[model samples]
Target: MQIRPFELERYFARHEFSAKYLLGSSDPEAMSIADLLAFEPGSEEELKRVWLGYTESLGDPALRRDIAGLYESVAPEEILVFTGAEEPIFAFMHAVLEPGDHLVVHFPGYQSHYSVAQSRGIEVSHWHGNPNRNWAPDLVELPELIRSKTRAILICTPHNPTGYLFDRSSWQQVIEIARERDLYLFCDEVYRGTEHDPADQLPHLADHYEKGISLNCLSKNCGLAGLRTGWIATKDRDIYNRLATFKDYLTICNCAPGEYLAGIAVRNMPQIFEQQRVRLVSNLNLLAEFFARHTDLFSWQRPRAGTVTFPRYLGGSALEFCDWLVAETGIMLIPGTFFDMPGEYLRFGYGRASFADALARLDAYLAG
Candidate 1:
């Protein structure tokens, strides 16, 4: 089936390699393979020996087990690996949705969440997150969007761009809605582990909803985007089987080396999260100061978790500002319009150690 272009990905493709300061990236500062390998006692030799053969189609059992350990209730048997979070989302929408099925999707979201479904002729309704509420979706709007044909509720927590984390109560309310509506709950939890406080991490959706499908990856939180390893955890046996069957036509199996490195990353998640948390907290404070200094030209609601935040530009259109900033100072920032958001806002990722440097350059650019 054909699909519309993924606008954000398309924009990245053209500028990502050429850009100087990548303030638009979603992943935190990435860790080297050597750093990740150091987590295990005997990893040096094992990493050197990781073969080039095709890995298990269902993913290496040990790797799946390591991923399962992240959730309290899921087992390794229920996890199915994919190339990346993007793959599972595309596969899932194709595997589960039909032409007339209605889907409730979070708006101002990652483009693929709705675009792929829309391509299949699925009826999609947006559940909007108001900017006045720090980009949090009103659960009140959910039921009104649901129709008899509604089949799924899609969400992103520790959400992309906005970094809004749902409290446990919000999670429970959404699960209750899905349960009552008989709709599948597809929660993209790729950023779940990056909560500002470890204690604030919410339960995996698969554990809380019978038909929930939780998608995760080593990209954002683990800072192992190069691994391209992601998975889906679901309690529904039927969906699990269907996804597996559908997988055969796509990537028959994951890359063997990436699997090994990702296994190492997953096993040392505690250290990774700790390092990333410290960086995010520090950078976010710097971002706060930056925005405060330019309050008249820009406005932002500090995010609760994750690597990025979308801020409104009072000076000019986001696209115009981003283009001028990049051309003048070699600092790259994403215009919110790339995510189908209004042109006044832009996404800024401040999880990198270079965030201060980027901010300084932006300051100079804006002053000139």
Candidate 2:
């Protein structure tokens, strides 16, 4: 099947290594492998002993159990691990969704959510987020988007770009719609623990909906992007088996080292996320002040959760403005065009160790 270029990933490839300050990275302040191994005693020895051969196609049993512990109702047997969140998304669309199958996906989301299926000629209807209402999708629109061929509804909670979280009622509304229509709910929940407020945490989609596929990874919440490990948790046996078998053609199993580290990361989720939360609040406060001071230049709502926010650039041409800003300040911000969103918007991420310094550069740029 012909594939569309992933603009966001492509843009990252071009600038991620060379940028002076990465202000638009989605992952939180990542740790050195030493820091990751430091969490658990004897981890250094375990890493040395980690087998080099292919691991279980499903995942390491220990790792799967640790991942299962993150959910309320999901079990180790129900989890299917992958190389990354992106790979499982590709597997699910290819293995479950076929051409002519209709998909309802959140708009202004990660491009791969809808684009892969669209590339397959799958009929796609966007569940658009309202900029007028802090970038939330109207649940009232779900019924209208459903059709006989509508096989799934995809969403990203504590979402990317906009960082919009569905309130309790809004969250239930989606589960209800999928249950009523028997549509698969593919929830990209990689940003699950990045909520600005603990009270705002939503139930794990896998635990709540029988057919819901909850996608998660160590990259975002745990700040272990180098692990490249992600997994889907669900109670649906058929879905689990299907994706597990499909894994053969792609990465048969995760890297043994990545799995070892990911298991450690997930098992110690509370500590890792607590650190991230503290840093998130600090950076978000900086972002709040930055935006308030330059209200004339930018329009943004402080993100309720997650590290990134989509802001409308009041200055000319978001792409051009980002280009000039990066060139002058050595700080990189993702242009809105990558996600196929409104022209004036750009994704700004403040979830890194360097965010403070990056914000200072931005402050200098705006002041000058």
Candidate 3:
């Protein structure tokens, strides 16, 4: 299948390692394998003992059980593991959606949410969020975006870049809309556990709606991107089976050691989430101060959750500014152009422990 170039991933490939400071990454600070195994006293030996043979395509049973516990009503049998969140998305695009089918997606989102489908000749409509309203999409516009061919509504909560977490009421409205149209709901919940306020967290869409497919990964919330573990949770057995079958064409099974490590991470999520939350909150405070100081150069709104925030650059073109900033100071920030967004917006990430240091460098650059 022909697909458009993945602008964001390609950009990261070029600079993610060489850049001195990454102010646009979405994952929280990662922990070492030793630190992860420390969560359970005997896990290190267990990890060492992990069989290097092929793992179950449905994922390690224990890992599925642990993932099941994250949802309120989903079972381990309903979970289909993938190499990462990207594979499941690709699976859904090929396995479920058809050429004539239509999809409605949250705007300024991860490109794959719509790109793969677009490549397959599916129609896509963006449900754009209002930046003036702290990036919240108007619920009223949602119903109107649906058409008879619309097969699904895709969204991200504790969203990437903008950090827009839906209030429970708005969250329900989205599910209800999908329910009314008998359309599937796909939620990119990779950032689910990183809410700035725990109360603001919404229920896993799969638990609340029968047609919902909730996608999650260890990369974002657990800061375990290297593990490359992600899964889909859905109550619908048919959908689960379809995704599982499609997996045969992809990474048939996940990495054996990665699954073992993922199991350890999932079993110990409470502490892991707490660790990320503490760091996120601390970095957010520093970001607020930095933004306050640079009001002349940026239009900012503190996001409710997630690792990154999109702010408007008062400087000429966001792309130009980011290019100049990175070249001059070795600090990397993503321009909104990468998200298919126009105007002067740029994504700023505050998930890393080095965020303060990065912000300091940007501040110093501005001063000089």
Candidate 4:
């Protein structure tokens, strides 16, 4: 199978390590492995007992059980864990989609949501979210995008870059469409737990739709990216079996250490999420003020979820602006063009302590 480059991952590979202050990262401030191990009262002793061996290919049973508890209705066995959110997306696209199978993907999203399937010769239609309307897709447009060969409707809620969360009505509309069309619903719920109002949290797509597959990870809400543990939860046993079999060809099993740490993180998800959400809300307020102070230079709406926001730059190409900012101030912000939107926008991640400092530097640069 011919595969094209993953644009965002490639950009990270080139700059992630060397960048001094990363203001483009999507993951929240990460918790160290030690922090995760220390979550429980007697975790120190439990940590010492963790074995170093090939873990269950389906993921450690305990971790799956803990993850299952996050959803309203799903069992541990129905979840198939993968190395990261990225891997499951690839596995699903390859395992389920075929050449000429039609896919409806939410646009201005993480590129992989569409590009990877397109690379495999799938007929892809974009469900575009209008930037003018708080970066939301019209639920009414979806039915028109469906066809006889349509196999899936892929969506990312509390989306990447834009951070727009779909309301209950929107999600209900999607569920109805998928049920009526008999199409698979692939919902990337990586940012599911980060709702501004916890009540805004929606049911796992798998629980809501027979063919729905809900993708999640420890990376975003739990701030456990280094664990590299993510999973796909589906009511469809066929998909679970296919992804489980496909796992052998990719990452056969989760890393023993990553799995161990992920188990602890999952078990303590409530506390972990609480800490991170507090930080995110605090930082988002700061970001709102920062944007207000520089209204002339950037156009942004305060995001409802996620750590990052894509802001339009009124002057110059984002690449040129970002390169100049990094070179002059040692602050790194991603050029939005990397995600296929260019010239006018760059992604600013306000999830880190250095975000304010970086904004100050950019302000100084703009002034000078």
- The number of the candidate with the highest TM-score is 3
Candidate 2 off by > 4 Å: none
Task: List the lowest-lDDT window of 10 residues for candidate 2.
Answer: 11-20
Give the per-residue lDDT of model 1 (tens digit) for 253-327.
999989988888888889988999999889889889889999999888988888999888998799988878777
Q: CA lDDT of each candidate? A: 0.89, 0.90, 0.92, 0.84
Task: Give per-residue lDDT, candidate 3, residue 327.
Answer: 80
Q: Which tens-of-lDDT digit does each residue in 164-242 have in candidate 4?
A: 8888898998999999988899999998778777787777898888899999998888888888999999999998899
Candidate 3 local lDDT, 32-137, one digit each (tens): 9999988899988898899998889999999999999988999999998899999999999999999999999999899999899999999999999899999999
Using lDDT, rank the candidates from best to worst: 3, 2, 1, 4
**Model 3, TM vs. native:** 0.98
Tell me which residue pairs clash in candidate 2: none
Winner on TM-score (1 vs 4) = 1
Off by over 4 Å in 1: none
- Candidate 1 matches the true fold with a TM-score of 0.98
For candidate 3, the C-alpha RMSD (Å) to the true structure equals 0.9
- In candidate 3, stretches whose alpha carbon ends up further than 4 angstroms from where it belongs are 16-18
